[model samples]
Target: MNHSLDGQVAIVTGAARGIGLGIARKLKADGARVAIWDLDVAGCDAQRLGFEADHLQPVDVASYESVERAFGATVEALGRVDILVNNAGINGPVVPSWEYPVDAWQRVLAVDLNSVFYCCRVAIPHMRARGGGRIVNVASIAGKEGVQYISAYSAAKAGVIAFTKSAAKELARDNVLINCVAPAMVETELFREMSDQHIEASKAKIPMGRFLQVDEVGSMVSWIASPACSFTTGFTFDLTGGRATY
Candidate 1:
């Protein structure tokens, strides 16, 4: 139960705000040197949140060059990356699949799915050299069970879940544990993109009948990112408020 990350270094993408920010906060509290990788560093409040001022790295997760460059900078500043949280994502639109914008769909997949791969592709080598590490991709319940109208979001998360599993198997012998959390809904700024009707309907599906709290998700990631989460790799830990019976 000791989710201590003492002496560890963690990189959390999409951390300018919302769930990613919460995860960064938790990691810092648990003793890890945390880096916030996002488009805008100022919005993440790294200093105010008690994170090292030098740990902020501006990055566009959707771009491979940007992610790679930031990774190098993070290493230069924080030394090494021992943990990676692929939490960057977007809920493109509420329209039906038939009516979705091609550009929007592509953008959603790029940020939500491709970026995870991009970051992992870069982090895995370093982790192997260090003999072990943790990678936690923030998935969603929609990935497990396809929702009614949010096709792009659901598909992207599902890919994240699958990628976590595949990548874990490849790194298991090396001791790099990789996993994901399939959350139903977390109250964050991302909610601004969701329609009220979509939010209520999604909440109704959860047996808990409420939106998840960002810190709750953050706590889960903290445990998964720590040495305490050994013996589990390429797995999906449910955080759907009793909604994920599987």
Candidate 2:
């Protein structure tokens, strides 16, 4: 697939590193002008140097106002945004749903789920103005299968999938397509943060006996964001390295 994303302007959140950075890099390589958004300004700068993309912005995806401001500035600087990738996320402490801290649960929901709302709420208008656009959300296998120890993260990601579906249906009428990619045990900084035992257990359960690569996920995201993905709105593409069979 040529998947020529050339001349498109995009915003990718949590893009300082990991899968988010991978998506940004792939989009840029496909010829999109990408703005990398991250909470860590220093990390964003370092990643920017590494990729040498079009732009970077420090954004708090959980705050609607902050998202609005950052996105506003991004559009003003980049001219317009045709693609939005909501990839900012955090996995709260691993514990049973009944025992998880209330604050931690709320925080996880805020970042993983609510941030999607914040970004879309702001970006939708821009898409409207542009006549059409694409939004590719970064969901997870936990969203579909409901991971045992990470109930809050699972629930929040599940919410993202639902939101993507709803938004896709609503926006498709206006030419904006929304979709999500759910990956399992991707080898990224976030995956490396897991406990050694958990990592071993995760590897053992995968049929591939290994984690998916970031660039692999990036390829799927790039396609979803491209004009080539027409006619498929509000769908979840599985990138789980065969672990997400249902």
Q: Which candidate is the best by TM-score?
A: 1
Q: What lDDT does each candidate get? A: 0.91, 0.89
Model 2 sits at a Cα RMSD from the real structure of 1.5
Residues 1-246 of candidate 1: C-alpha lDDT, one tens digit per residue: 768899999999988788998898899888988888888887556356656543888899999999999999999988899999999888999999999999999999999999999999999999999999999999999999999899999999999999999999999899999999999989988788989999999999999888899999999999999888999999999999899989
The per-residue C-alpha lDDT of model 2 at residue 68 equals 91
Clashes of 2: 0
Q: Can you give the TM-score per candidate against the true fold? A: 0.97, 0.95
Give the alpha carbon lDDT tens digit for every residue of 1-246 in model 2: 559998999999998888898998899889999998988757555435466767878888888889999998998889999999999999888887899999999999999999999999999988988899999999998899998888999999999999999988788789999999998887877865578877777777678777889899889999999978989999999987788776
Clashes of each: 0, 0
Residue 48's lDDT in candidate 2: 51
Clashes of 1: 0
Runs of candidate 2 exceeding 4 Å displacement = 43-49
